[model samples]
Target: MKMFWVLTLAGILVAGMGSRDGAVAQTRVPQKVMKYLESHSFQDLVRRYGNTTIELSVPSREARYLDSLPYRLEAGFRVQVVATTDKQNASNIYRQVKQLQLDSTYLVQEQGLFKVQVGNFTVRDSARKLLDQLYYAGFKDAWIAPATIHIAKKAKVLPTPSDSIYFAIQVMATHSRSKAEETAQTIRKKWNLPVRILAEGNLFKVLAGNFSEESMARQQLQYLREHGWPDAWLTQLLPN
Candidate 1:
């Protein structure tokens, strides 16, 4: 009788396991097992058996695949709306853009300048379209800037000596070391552009960017003027 009951119970459990929907089987449990379970509450059984914890394990194939992937860079074009020495102004402009439902707006501090920039575009044409939208929406100073945008970590690349022979925009100069650092920090934070402070005798000269050509520097100078650095001047950086 016990052997016969075991065969019947196995058949019922097999039917239950086969169903995708997992509806309870109409097959009834063996009377003896059902009676034993009915006498013991689920909580009581769990307390008696104690508990075990489980952690998910990664497959070796998946772990190796993830390790083999190469590091990728995500540098691209962006539309800069405004930059200012005042933090409050940057905050206000950022809020204004957000209110206009311009979702990609960002406020960054560089040297001493706080800038509100928008969008991650892979091409100049895409950034230009956003620039037109911003201008039409009353942000007349908006312009596109090509930059190295890091999604994960910044890429490490060694520059050749010849790379220093480029134009730069000198936005400010002062005798105070603190003042030079503050301004340079703001510019770097806002634009991700290179900023340098040269000790020109007593004065500390704060300069930004190393454009490969004079025209490129002039273009950036105009952009800086429209975006709040009106006194910006272009200077060539001779390779040392």
Candidate 2:
């Protein structure tokens, strides 16, 4: 009975080897066998592992701020009037210019220094002209420092006022009504000078004195610098 069982096993092994050899000689797996193996293997893998889930989480703050930066960079020029470690000095400069109704004037604190800047001029010449005016305004330390001025847009200077051909000491221009009023009031009370807050286009222009002659305006401008106002420039109103 044991010999009979051994013979039976040998016959089964021989039959399997013969079938494999025949398949090798044919150089191809049977289509049904290949299909069965692929389907079964994939199904088994999916059953064992497909139900597994990977949970991904990111910091809420990082996710919220991923699309934007805290500060923006822009290509432009601005006249840096003064930079000092003293906040009061910077604020004083700011008030002086703001009183002149200069729209783009700002007091910024950076690197332990308070900086006062003015204008968002695209052209270097524009900044230079402003720098010249600032120098006379009493900020002799003022110069054109090329920088990305922090502002929405540059203030547009309107057409010349149509009052008459009179030259006035142009102090500054500002877009803020409160700033214009504040500056005008300070100059009026402090110096008792003739202060005119003219609305020329989008800007409120602060003029010190109106002169019928350019020469007289220049002389007055000089006197203004000698007193306290330095950024005064001789400007012709109602140009011919």
Candidate 3:
């Protein structure tokens, strides 16, 4: 009986191998025969387990942050300070900062290096004025230093004759001639208002502001009058 069973298993294994990839796959598999043939391989196994594959993908790397830096441009200037040969200059600056209420402070740059900075103002002209004033006020070492100003990214507000009084200043003419020059300088110096002078024929008309409301213009004019510039007045600059 053992010999008969052994012969039957061997016959099933041979039949399975022959019919693995053919129409004669109707071969009956006994449990022992199936286990014996399970470890064998065929063309499908060769295509799956022996096949090499390469994937197309992006390589892993540390992310770059260079593009995230700001493109905001700052017009730069430098400020000169007392060069500390010893502790004296730094001490003088520290003392004067308290005495004068200056909006600047000291920066410890490195070993044996210290910097006195005045302001981080948005206006370049203001910085220049501060430098000049400091120098003229006996701080000869005062000068401007080129520093990057982090200006907020925004759509630039342009200089135009804007009126809030429901009417715009319509200048029939403009010129940089002598009377026009005088009027501009006078307005800026006296009333803290920028002057724009216009010429129609031989007449030199100086207009100080653009306002949407006549009441606002009157208020500004009143302020100018209080400052003793009585000649300041308002009129419709709009062309008829």
Candidate 4:
């Protein structure tokens, strides 16, 4: 029911955004998610409630409910795993990634040292993609783990840019539009996230995902990295 209202509101926004005379009115846009949504149209969706909503041009089926937040089902057949060396010298890597504010974590420690594992991608292809990124980063030992599949919802308490997705490669802090655009191009083609340039004052952010879930964003990150963007990381954009 809420999803219906949200979709209805989105349609109204797109159809009623402006006039040549410069009328001023405000309707809520998922501020963080707006950039990606700009690349898509509500009419583009093939409505899940009926045959009316436009489907995202991707290959997944609609969930049983709206917002689909309560039931994020996996869309592919294979699961992916990202493996790196045992955490003997991973402290520096961890610190660097942490400083950048990415969710760098390791599995429960076992054996002689800690092993950094980024994810268990629901799709084998998605996992393999990240494996390639790890290999190029000089960690040739990464592989996929396909056995942990489950139909579950990743409860995201915060609504991220609840629109479309765009991933831009970026520096921690700076506004070099050209650099950001170049990075966006790489990811737009690679991950199909429709990358764009977002400038917040002087901090140039490489954003992705009007995406609703962290898992999907992470997969998109993996996809971008595999396609020659080794420097890309997840950029969280909160909802309005």
How do the predictions measure up, each by TM-score? 0.34, 0.36, 0.29, 0.33
Over 122-214, each residue of candidate 1 has an lDDT whose tens digit, in order, gives: 566656766888999999988998754323122122242664676778988799999999989998897677888988899999888876645
Between 1 and 2, whose TM-score is larger? 2
Predicted structure with the largest lDDT when compared to the true one: 1
Q: Each model's C-alpha lDDT?
A: 0.64, 0.60, 0.48, 0.46
Candidate 3: residue 191 lDDT (0-100): 51
> Candidate 3: minimum summed lDDT over ten consecutive residues — where?
1-10
Sort the candidates on TM-score, descending order: 2, 1, 4, 3
User: Candidate 2 lDDT, tens digit per residue, 1-240?
Assistant: 000101121121111121212431223445774665466555564554454432224345554564243223467678898889989878987899878655357787778989898866555665676687788878798888777743222112223345667777777788987787887888778756567788978899888655565544554554454345556667776644
- Tens digits of per-residue lDDT, candidate 4, 30-128, equal 666577556665656324222332223322344334345443434432212233455545665555334433332444344554445554344566566
Model 3 TM-score is: 0.29
Clashing pairs in 2: 99-183, 101-173, 101-174, 136-230, 136-231, 137-230, 137-231, 138-230
Model 3 score (lDDT): 0.48
The CA lDDT at 122 in model 1 is: 54
User: Relative to the unseen true structure, what is the C-alpha lDDT of residue 211 in candidate 1, on a scale of 0 to 100?
Assistant: 63
Model 4: runs farther than 4 Å from truth? 1-175
